[model samples]
Target: MKTQDQAAQGKVALVGAGPGDPELLTLKAVKAIFRADVLLVDDLVNPDILDHARFGARIIHVGKRGGCQSTPQEFIERLMIAEARAGHFVVRLKGGDPFIFGRGGEERAHLLDAGIEVDIINGISSGLAAPSSIGIPLTHRDWSQGAVFVTGHGKTADANPDWDALAKLGMTLVIYMGVARCREIQQALLAGGKPASTPVAVVHAATSGSQAQLITTLGDLPAALTESRLASPSIIVIGDVVRCASQDLFHRLTAEPDRIAG
Candidate 1:
């Protein structure tokens, strides 16, 4: 009934779902979800956020978790292109800010190469949410003048962050995907002249109802995590600004050395 030129010309939207809180989604993200004909969702996106989707919308779960089996990136890109060419509004929903380690850049490049239209809607990043949830200010006049967000793990060994240079930056350090490599990260920072007494905070599932957190010094981080049993999907904040965390959340694990708050 319709010719190729008469069919709808669909576009792709790379929308950030925020850090696990449905309420944290931006107004633009909500509208995009409502308008999408097909949504490719990542594992970290909150399932509840789908309530905004229009009825009869196709939702595809493309789980991508570190150290777990995940949908291939190539397949996702191809699907987006195929769906768009078929006159479907494709929404690629990712957790946290899409540009902040969510692989939005890669997807955008692929879509452009295929001559598909794309739009990006930003959302709150977990790095910002994790520290704020506990009342820890990332930047303080007396504590830290700025902050740096780095990934603890990289796609490849050579892709890993330079912990040595990061240690000497004299700013608040917020680490993503660092829990599995806690000991290695700690040792690298220590070897790079970061003091063993530097304060650290590890927040799990930050901003979610099941959130948990621990506070300790750099030297005790590995042991603290082992005791707390906090795993991936956690944010590690390192610097003096951790001292600014709310007293209500502070529980001293021991009094001998630096205080371990759990």
Candidate 2:
């Protein structure tokens, strides 16, 4: 019995586009995009996702691209604030899970401060999705129990990741924005007494057609990754779980004679 007028009041939804794969999007997120009156998105988000917006909504691009002059975060928040104030439902879309370096926290705080009704729609993060697609488990009783997600691409002033702790902890290490620092990080971990032969898996353009998963050892990770010509938006995973993905894929690929070379 709700009136159409009552339903038209503005609301804001922060949506996660997932790590470049449209298939990885959650159903709720898909529904929210389709319902949006205005969609504000980031550059990392894949283009295919826009097909889900069935409402013929206005799509606004306010994304922060790597190495580019990013549109100020405060400006993006104000855009959301201004649009929602006009009584249009706005969707702030980001690539990957919103909470994981997606900058959703800032926007959330801004909207709430302005007294706008807001909600977050979670999506798959590349951290876990990339490895899983390559058939790696993050934890194993026999290998390692903890999994650490770190950002390796940001400013040195903010944090050059704690190489010392990561080296000693037996956790599965998942690093984002790692391409730039791959060599340095690998060397640091190697210097910290982490086995030079420890397995490492680098997933590039994960969960998409351009995807490539390369398995190598920590010592050779830098060379292997560089040789493969993989680009940004990739993830680097180190630990025994690297073997898990390789073994799983090997068994599966080996089991299928059709896939094997004659």
Candidate 3:
């Protein structure tokens, strides 16, 4: 029989908040949020989803926004360990699928090393959702044999993906957080033998009311992005499948001039 203190040792739940839509949150994620005594939320997570938390649940904003004053990963891990040891059911809420560039793995490792149990609740990733929202299929038998998802930014400069190799993969490429480096990416792909006429699309704030999209060709991508002023929190899709976007659906997706472009 364990003592009260021993039995009170709490566990951590790494919950994915999905892209920007509250409705995209998984039932497991919702249940985790409702049961959490404390939640460490990320910057990109939609605020509306927080409403799922039970009244009196302590919400902590530990979001790490790029190019901004962000929470240190070490600090976040420590906070989670501290909260859990204090007998609080801690929920580390992140935008998109927690394992998909959300750094959930690092947090899980830290907690496990500290002897804290961690549960992962998967959610929709923007890499998949964004393209679909704009009528672009990631993979199509006639257009692409496969697809690849790569991050635009890496922890170190040398860790950056080899654009040349990626271009040679002969598959659709879905880039996350690549808006800032769109010009460099375009140049790399162009130099890697990818045709200048390859179709491309940029989807911003996917699955949310503020969602927007831009359709262009590889040759025009850099200039199009510069002229359009699309920013971070966007996904870039490149491949022949972009050409497969239904004409009627494209028109409907772009109906709001302010929210879409070509």
Alpha-carbon runs more than 4 Å astray in model 3:
1-5, 246-262
Task: Mark the regions of model 2 whose C-alpha exceeds 4 Å error after superposition.
Answer: 1-9, 248-262
Clashing pairs in 1: none
Instruction: Give the per-residue lDDT of model 3 (tens digit) for 1-262.
Output: 9788768999999999999999988898999999999999999999999999999999999977766789989999999999999999999999999899999888899999998989999989999999888678899999899999999888899988899999888899999989888889989999999998788889889998888778877888877787878787899999988876758544533453232363
TM-score of each candidate?
Answer: 0.94, 0.87, 0.93
lDDT of 2 by residue, 173-195 (tens): 99988877888898889888899
Supply candidate 3's per-residue lDDT for 246. Answer: 57
Question: Candidate 3: minimum summed lDDT over ten consecutive residues — where?
Answer: 251-260
lDDT of 1 at 153: 90
TM-score-best of 2 and 3? 3
Q: Write the per-residue lDDT of candidate 1 for residues 138-216, one digit (tens) a residue.
A: 9999989999999999989999999999999999999999999999999999999999989899999888888889888
Choose the strongest candidate by lDDT: 1
* The best candidate in terms of TM-score: 1
Better of 2 and 3 by lDDT: 3
